[model samples]
Target: PMYFFLANFSFLEICYASTTLPRMLMNLGTQRRRISLVACATQMCFVLMFGVAECLLLAVMAYDRYVAICNPLNYPLVMNHRVCIQLVTGSWTTGIPFLIEYTYQIFSLSFCGSNQINHFFCDVFPILKLACGDTFVNEMLAYMVAVLFGMVPFLLILGSYSKLISIILKLPSVTSQAKAFSTCSSHLMVVILFFGSAIITYLRPNTRHSEGTGKVLSLFYTILTPMFNPMIYSLRN
Candidate 1:
């Protein structure tokens, strides 16, 4: 089950990185930083789709760890092949409806003024800043989506790890506790890097000063985190 979850996660990291990096590299190489409105919207849709999936999938991974560590005797039965597939499927599909709607809402807005996006990619806040009319509804919707997709899964990961830590501490032998901790430490590190940067990027107020900071933070989760995930997980081997 652990490998199953890891395999899905590794694939997700690939898809996630592909959504932004290829375009980013193309723009960098050609020095043509412009993207068509349709293309930008398409990129945003895929980014949100994979981003939300990654959040949910991380929580699912955390739950898998919880079952393995805290319910070792029944781990195989609890995380059987069918159940694992269901969990992964749910994680990937759960946010599609909300994200599609969210992307449509943002792109449907009347964008005017500079037209140049402030960030490297078509992120929510940067795109919202370009809209001509009132964006209260869009801003509110972004917050709602952030809370629903970002915070909810983040809290689940925290809860799972909290319970897992308690259980590990209560184990009889130091070696057992160490082994248990080793299984999840890589995941814990990833959760922190991914969610911490993501929450900061999404939940914070959109301001002129923060745009630069937001881009930097976006690089962490979108680029650096994905780049580091394989190294982080491989070390566990």
Candidate 2:
């Protein structure tokens, strides 16, 4: 069931990523492709919504790990049928509103000049960068998104891992500790890649990162990280 669920999520990832990335790729090849205003708005909504949902799912997966390893005896009891419903529902609940805010911000902005976004997908920052008119409102909304979507979930994962590490250290043998660390290290890597790029892009103190750097780093989380998850996890184990 978990496999099926993750497969569905990954399918959505491909659909969502393709909606924007494919357009960008086509534009790169042809040197002239433009999104209709409505298409751009729709693309941004799906991208943002799916991205947020993926994060919530990752956090829930982390919580599942916490329950499974820390209390195996009660794992089934703790993550019961009804509880799983609530968890998945909560992910959608949190994701949908962010989508609304993002789309609202995007629609409110004026795009007069070239609407060519450098990076794949109609991501908030890159789209906002091209907005011709006053983008103060969009910038504020972006900052709010940075806080809610980028930082908070990252802190949640960090906090969970802190306790997870504490529990791992309590294991009696070095071999046991190594085993736990190996399983955890992949998840830790994903969390790092996802949050690291996002924070550097949005929560940046210094805007020294170049356009090339921004595109590459964003690809790590959005395009590459999801692909890496299964490979890294399987290889590590």
Candidate 3:
């Protein structure tokens, strides 16, 4: 079950990185920084889709580890093939409706002034700043979405890990405890890196000083985390 979840996560990381890096690299190579509204919207949709899916998938992985370590007898029964597939499907599809509406709301607004996006990618706050009209509602909605998809899943992962740690500590032998912790250490590193960067990027105040900081932080989750995931898991092996 762990490997299964990791494989899905690896695939998700590929998709997530592809959503932004190719375009970013092209712009850097050709010096054509301009992006059409349609293209921007498309990028936003995929970025949101894959980003939200990853948050949910990581939570699911945490839950899988909790089940395996805390309920060894029931792990196979609980995390059966059908159940795993359903969880993956739910992770992938859960945020699509909300994200579609969120993307639409962002793009529907007027952008009469300079269309220059402050960031490398067409992220929510960067695009919001470009809109000529009032963006108070959009900002609030973005916050709500971040709390729902980003923070909520993070909390879930934390809860699962809390239980896992308690169970691991209760194990009789040091070797057994080490084994249990080993199963989760890679995932914990990933969760911290990915969610830490994401929370800082989305949940914080967007200010002129922080725009540059946010772009750099965005690279952690969007580019660096994905790049590190395979290495982290493989090193665990």
TM-score of each: 0.98, 0.85, 0.99
RMSD of each: 0.8, 2.7, 0.7
Q: 1-237 in candidate 1: lDDT tens per residue?
A: 889989999999999999899999999999999998888998999899999999999999999999999998999999999999999999999989988888988888886688888898998899999899999998998898899999999999999999999999999999999999999999999999999999999999788998899999999999999999999999888
Off by over 4 Å in 3: none
- Lowest summed lDDT across 10 adjacent residues in model 1 is found at 107-116
Provide the overall lDDT of each model, using Cα atoms, as 2-decimal numbers: 0.93, 0.73, 0.94
What tens-digit string does per-residue lDDT give for candidate 3 at 1-237? 888888899999999999999999999999999888899999999999999999999999999999999999998999999999999999999999999999999999998998899888999999998899999999999999899999999999999999999989999999999999999999999999999999999998878899999999999999999999899999999
User: Best candidate, lDDT-wise?
Assistant: 3
Residue 105, model 2: lDDT of 63
Question: lDDT tens digits, residues 97-157, model 2?
Answer: 7678669867786778876777666677778778888887777877777778767787788
Which is the winner by lDDT between candidate 1 and candidate 3?
3
* Sort order, lDDT high to low: 3, 1, 2
TM-score-sorted candidate list, best first: 3, 1, 2
lDDT, candidate 2, equals 0.73
